[model samples]
Target: MHDSKNALSVQKLIADLAGIVRIMDQKDQQLAPAINAPSQSWLETWMTAFWETLCREWASIDQWRMNKVLLLVRFFIREQFGLALEWAVKQDPKLKDQVARQLRVLEAWPLSPRERRVPDGLRLHVLDVWTEELAGQLSAAQKALDEDAENSDPESKKSILLSLAQEFMEPVRKISREAISKGVKIRAKEAVKLAEEQLSG
Candidate 1:
């Protein structure tokens, strides 16, 4: 038996499972093959356990597992497979609220399911409503870079922020490419550049 304390590290597993589950949840249903794939049996076993764990967690109606919930939202929006998400939501009515609106946005405007197989670093062609959230995160990172007056010098702090920003910029690039193809305006072109500098400098 798995250790009670370490049996699954359900919390960590939830976070790690984010990438795999998003493929299962995306409405693209065709992408199911990508996420459903695993070289190891442990993956299938873990996901099945996660499914059951989701039920256990649902009984308590807790939001502590929200990271996994967010990942599930990604799967529903981007993955080709819809069954895993549908099954999960059907199993737990509570999961509906966290992901339903996002799923609606995806269904409202979807791109090629095959594109989902591309790494998130390369495949995020466009973000629907989620851009606002991404912007907020980048903005917060910028503010931290600008406002660390109390803790560190601006240049040093900026170096940290720049590194953070650069890491974020790659996704922005993909989003911009995707959005441009779809004819949506980008909100943070400058922020993307700033992050690039951070990443390189």
Candidate 2:
């Protein structure tokens, strides 16, 4: 009976994650054209009014993307990992100690400070790194989860998930915020550069 319950829980979690991924895919499709649109011509770019409008549009799109990613992270933490950890603790009180230890390790992990300066022209690269890091972590977690499900030990599987959650939750949020902020700064700098070029020309 216990094994059956664990199996069902794992299946449900995987299904939920799959559904979220599908939604994200749809959003990506919707956003891709706008994000990948060609840059404005030099003449249009020189107009201060047009430049300001472009900056706003780009910032809005970037913020929307960041918000979606953050929402997914929050959903994973609250709906999936949080509930699973709570269930595990209720099932085996001894597991709480292990969770605590894992959390301590996570807490000790060095997080890049939120206010760290992002170099000019490197914003997109930094954002890519942040996005890749989160994607890599999620992919690794999913793989580990599949491996854990194959094992006969339900407690061990829950422990592993809990550890993964502890390691990722805060870092994901931090990186998302940093990425969004850097994107905004990049847009501002771009606007200024456009104005400068216009004046120089």
Candidate 3:
């Protein structure tokens, strides 16, 4: 178990990381129109360098002894890092397929014996949404989820179904206030009902 001091240090590091991501996002929004390709190219270069350095450092760590850090990093991969990757893909549509594959790889990282448990309901949902967001199509994520559902054991099936509920609970709520397509909204609601019935049984 992590001592409080180590836990605090991790929290501080995560906060700093969060700040960096937000700054990058804000700059992207502010300068995207004026500088266009050059700005995006520069940002992509920086992001690539940062990711490579991070991967190297990650490899050098003794993650088994750092369970708390490992769990936080896995959650970061599922959420913030995935969002950053999705943003990168948005800035370059050609990279969509590549980033999607990488995101899936990161998503699966948490399931390694190092983590000792499946991703919980909320993280599963966030990962699925990022997949959809990156693809600019919910159908892609839904299809993948359906395939997983088909292949999973009954216990894993519950996690898959819970993700469906999460899809509706969060994104659907925001989409409701936006001018989203009717078909997408209907599909999301249906997913929620499907999750409810299956999980209830």
Top TM-score hit: 3
**Local distance difference test, per candidate?**
0.40, 0.39, 0.42
Predicted candidate 1 versus true structure: per-residue lDDT over 57-165, tens digit per residue: 5445334444445455354333312222333323343333323333332322332222332223212333332333344444554565466666555555445444433
Q: After superposition, how far is residue 178 of candidate 1 from its true place, in Å?
A: 7.3
Q: After superposition, how far is residue 193 of candidate 1 from its true place, in Å?
A: 10
Q: Which model, 1 or 3, shows the larger lDDT?
A: 3
Q: What digit string (tens of lDDT, one per residue) describes model 3 on residues 1-201?
A: 645554446656667766765665566556656863532533344445554444445535554434544544544444443344334423355344334434344333321212223333322333334333322322333344456645445444434333433432444333323313444444445544443443331
All candidates' TM-scores?
0.27, 0.25, 0.36
Across 1-201, the per-residue lDDT of candidate 2 in tens digits comes to 224332324446546755654453345335545755422322212222322333344444454345443443344333323333433434444334333433333222212323233232233332233333333444444455556645566546546554544444454344434434655445434433433332210
Q: State model 1's lDDT.
A: 0.40
Clashing pairs in 2: none
